[model samples]
Every structure is written in structure tokens, then in C-alpha cells.
Target: MNLDPALRAILVCPQCRGDLTDDEAAGGESGLVCPACRLRYAVSDDGIPDMLVDDAQPLG
Candidate 1:
């Protein structure tokens, strides 16, 4: 699912409250990565972002 530009501009990481950038791969799965927290929040199948901190994946 494609994220809306307007929504992306305002969505922040729940852990550090930092800006999130799209880290979508060529295969079509999408994630929102927070540079400050080094966490990746997964985007749901229906296009909704799962921004919950507990659900975030750790970034290497």
C-alpha cells in the first residue's frame, strides 16, 4: 500500500518521537523506519500503519 504524503509528513516514531521515512522494498512490502530510534514499524496490509511501539522491529 502507498502511504499518503500528507500523513507521512506528520507520522512520528512512538519510541523517540522522531521522523519516519519509507523503507519500502522492491517486492511491495512497506515499513516506516525511524532514524533516531532505529526501529521499523510495519505497514499493515490494508494500508494502515502499525505505529505501536511494542510492535516495532529493531533495526540493525
Candidate 2:
């Protein structure tokens, strides 16, 4: 599925408050990442962002 460009334009990393990118290969499966904080947030089944701190996984 094509990602919403508007969503991409607004989304920021919850941890670092930095810009976010659509990692298509990692999209849905691994969610989004904050390059600055190295945090990974899970994307919901409905494509909503689950931005809770506890839900974020440490980057590799």
C-alpha cells in the first residue's frame, strides 16, 4: 500500500522530535525509526502511529 505523503510530512520521532522517513522495507513490519535517537516505533494495523515511549524498541 502507498503511504500517505501528508502523514510523512507531519510525523516526527517521538523520542528525538526529528523528521521521519518511510522505510518501506521496514514499513508495517517494523514500523518507523528515529535516526537521531535510534528508536523504533511500531505501526498499527490501521496505519496509525503508536507513539508511546514504552512501545518503542531500541535501534539495532
Candidate 3:
């Protein structure tokens, strides 16, 4: 399923509440990152955010 644009517009990183942008660089799997916290949240298959720190895999 595609991500909800409205939800994406308002979504922020849970750790820092910083603005998030589409992580197209990480393949089609969408993700958001907080520059301040250097934390990234991955979008689940169901379009829900997996905002756990452990869930974020380090960028290669």
C-alpha cells in the first residue's frame, strides 16, 4: 500500500520531533530521519511507522 500523504506531511521523528523526508535512497522501503537525533524510522508493510530505535538498521 502507498503511504498516506497527509500522514506523511505531519509525521515527525518520535525521538527528536524533527522534520522527516522520504528515504528513497533506502530503496522503495520508505523511511524518515531526524537530523538532530540521527535517528531513522522505517515504514512498515502496513504503512504504519516502526519507530523503534532497534528497528532502524544502520545505513550502509
Candidate 4:
């Protein structure tokens, strides 16, 4: 799902409260990534981002 530019600009990491960036290298599995906490947040097929902390995937 493609994320909205406006939403992406304001969306922060649920764990570290740091800025997030879209990582195209995630092979479409990870939509947003928090560099500070090394977490990847997934996006639904409906274009909604799952920003929940518990649902975040750890970055390798």
C-alpha cells in the first residue's frame, strides 16, 4: 500500500518516538522504518499503516 505523503511526514515511531522513513528496500513487506529503534512498521493492503508498537517488526 502506498502511504500518504502528509501522513508519512508526521508519523513517528511508537517505540522511540522518532521520525520514520519509507524503505523501498524492504521488498514491500515493511512500509515504514524507524532508524532510532530499528523497527519496521507494516502497511495494510487498504493503505492504512499499522503503527502499533507490538505489531512492529524488528529490523535485521
Error of 2 at 47 (Å): 0.5
Clash tally, candidates in order = 0, 0, 0, 0
lDDT of 4 at 14: 82
TM-score per prediction, in order, is: 0.81, 0.71, 0.67, 0.80
**Full-model lDDT for every candidate:** 0.84, 0.70, 0.71, 0.80
Better of 3 and 4 by lDDT: 4
Pick by lDDT: 1 or 3, better one: 1
Clashing pairs in 2: none
What lDDT does candidate 1 reach at residue 32?
Answer: 93
lDDT (10s digit) by residue, model 2, range 1-60? 243568867889876789765554444373777888877777765677777878888777
Best-matching candidate per lDDT: 1
Q: Model 3: how large is the Cα RMSD against the reference?
A: 2.4
Worst 10 residues of 2 by lDDT: 21-30
lDDT of 3 at 42: 79
Name the 10 consecutive residues with the lowest summed lDDT in model 4.
Answer: 22-31
Which of candidates 1 and 4 reaches a greater TM-score?
A: 1
Best model per TM-score = 1
Model 4 TM:
0.80
